[model samples]
Target: MKTLTVPDETPVFPLRWVVATNDEAAPLVIRLMLALVLFPHGAQKLFGWFGGYGFDGTMQYFTETVNLPYLLALSIILIEFLSPFLLVAGLFTRVVGVLISLLFTGIILTAHVAIGFFMNWNGSQPGEGYEYHLLIVAMAVSLLISGGGKLSLDSKLAK
Candidate 1:
C-alpha cells in the first residue's frame, strides 16, 4: 500500500490582510449601523422575531412565491440571519461585507429594480424599491474597503 501525502498550501481562512483594519471611528460606526439595521431583519427571518415569518415560512415563500432555488433561499436566510452577529463582532468584516453586497445586489436585480428607485412611502406603489438595498450595498462596500475599524476584532487580529 502506498501512502499519499497532501500538499501544503496557503490556508484559506484567517488571512491577515483580509481582516486587517484601522483604529478609526468611521468604519466602526458604519459597521455598527449596518449590524443594528440588519439584526432585526435577520432575526425576523430566522426566529420569527419582529413579525417575521421565520425559517419555514420564509423558505416556503421564497421557493413557492418568489421562485427561488432552495439553496439560494437557504443561503439568503442564513446570511441575513447570521451575518449581523459576525458583523457586530467585526470578524471577517470584508468577507461579510462582500456577502452582504452580493446578497443585496441579487435582491435588487431580482425584486426591486422592477418596482423603481423610490420606496413606497405611501401605499401608491405596488411594491418597495431598490433604494434601501442600494444603501446597504454602499455600507457593505465601505466595510470592504475600510475594514471593521476601531475596537474591531479585525484590528486585534491584524496585530
Candidate 2:
C-alpha cells in the first residue's frame, strides 16, 4: 500500500469573496480623514455638539423648515452618527460609502445647489454650498470602488 499526503488549505469566508484588500496608505488616510470630518457633524446632530441642533431640534427643523418626512429626518441623524464610525473602523465600507453618498446627494440637490458653489464666501450669504458635499461624495465613491484599506477591520476579518 502507498501512503498519500494531503496539502494544507487555508479556510475561506464568504466575505473574502465579496471584499478585497489593498493595504495601501491612501485609502486608509482617506477613510480616516472622512471619519474625522463627518464625525463632528454627527456629534452635533445627535448631541448638539459644536453648536449643531440636537436630535429633537433637527427633527423639527427638517420637518417644518425643510419639510422632509420624519423618517427621513431621523434617518439623516442616524446615518450621520453611525456611518462615520463604521467608515473609520473600516467595516462595511462599500455600503457605508453608498449611504453617505446618497445622503450628501439629497443634501446638495435640496439645499446646497441653491446656495451656489461656495459657502457664504466673505460672509456674503447666510448658508453653505454644494462644494463640500461634492468633495465628500468624491471621497466616498473612491472608497466604494476600492473598499477599505489595509488597516481596516474588513481586511482583518476577511482573513
Candidate 3:
C-alpha cells in the first residue's frame, strides 16, 4: 500500500472579503492626518486659535465678503468646529465627514477657486489656494466612504 500526503490549507475569512476587501489601514490614516490638519482651522474660526479668524471675524468674512446670510455663516461655523471635533475623537464620523465634505465644497467654490494654485498668504496675490481645500475635500470624501476605523469612537460606541 502507498501512503499519500495531503497539503494543509488555511481557512480564509469570507466576511472580511465582504466588508473590507483591502487593507483597512488607509482610511484610518487619512482620518488622523486630516483631523490634525483641519481641526486647527476650525479652532481658529470658532475660538481664534492658530492665527485663525474667530467667530466675529469669520462672521464678518461670511457676511460682508462672501455675501452669505448670518444663518448660513452660523451653520458653517457650527459644522466646521463641531464636526472636526467629532472626527478627531472618531465619533459619529460618517455623518460628520459628509457634512464637512459639503462644507469644503462650498468654501472651495466660493472663496478658494479664484485664488488659483499658489499659496499666497497675502490677499494681494492670487494663490495656490484651492489646492489645499481640494485635498481636504478628498480626505473628507474618503472618510465618508470608509467611516471611522477600529481606532475610532464610532467603533467603540458601536460595541
Candidate 4:
C-alpha cells in the first residue's frame, strides 16, 4: 500500500486544431467562391450578359480567329456555362475543375498572355490581363486535386 501520483500527459497542438476546424468550412466556402466568380463569366459567354460577346461573337472569334471548329466553340461555351453551376453546387467538382482549368488555360494563351502581364485589354497603363486568369487556373488546380471536401454536394450525394 502506498500513495501513488500520476503525472499528466497531454499534447498541445493549437495550429493543428485551428487548421482542422478551418478545414470543416473549406469545402462549401471554396465551392461557393469558385461558383460565384465563374458563373457570371460563363453566363456572359453563353447568354451575352453584362456586355459579353454572345454566341455569334464568340463563334467568330473561335472559328475565324482562334481557328477552332464551331463544335469546339459550342463545347467550350456549354462546358463553361454548365460546369460552373455544377461546381457551385459542389457536384462532379473534379470533372468540372479539369474542364474549367483547360478552358482558362486556352483563354490565357489565346488572349491575355499576348498583351503582356501589366497591360489592360484597352492597352491602358494599368492592365486587366492574364493575371486574373492565372489565379483562376490555380484555383481550378486546387479543386481538381482536393475534390469538393466534406461540406459539398459531392459529399452529400455520396451519402
What lDDT would each prediction earn against the true structure?
Answer: 0.90, 0.85, 0.73, 0.72
Model 1: lowest-lDDT 10 consecutive positions = 3-12
Stretches off by above 4 angstroms in model 4 are 1-23, 119-128
Task: lDDT winner between 1 and 3, please give it.
Answer: 1
> Which regions in candidate 1 have their CA more than 4 angstroms from the true location?
1-14
Report the error of model 1 at residue 108, Å. Answer: 0.6
- Scored by lDDT, model 2 comes in at 0.85
User: Which of the predicted structures, 3 or 4, would earn the higher lDDT when compared with the native?
Assistant: 3
Across residues 46-121, which tens digit of lDDT does each residue of candidate 1 receive? Answer: 8899999999999999999999999999999999878888888898899999999999999999989999999999
Q: Which one is best on lDDT?
A: 1
lDDT of model number 1: 0.90
Q: Which regions of candidate 3 are displaced past 4 Å?
A: 1-23, 121-124
**Compared to the true structure, candidate 2 yields what TM-score?**
0.86
Candidate 4 structure quality by residue, lDDT tens digits, 1-159: 333333553433322211121235565666778788887777887779978998788878889998998998998889877877787667777777788889899988977787776536565644457888887788887777777776666665443
Candidate 1 global TM-score: 0.89
Cα RMSD of all models vs. native, in order, equals 5.2, 5.9, 10.3, 11.5
lDDT of 2 by residue, 72-141 (tens): 8899999999988888889888778888999999899988898799877687876898899999999988
Candidate 1 at 20: error in angstroms?
A: 1.2
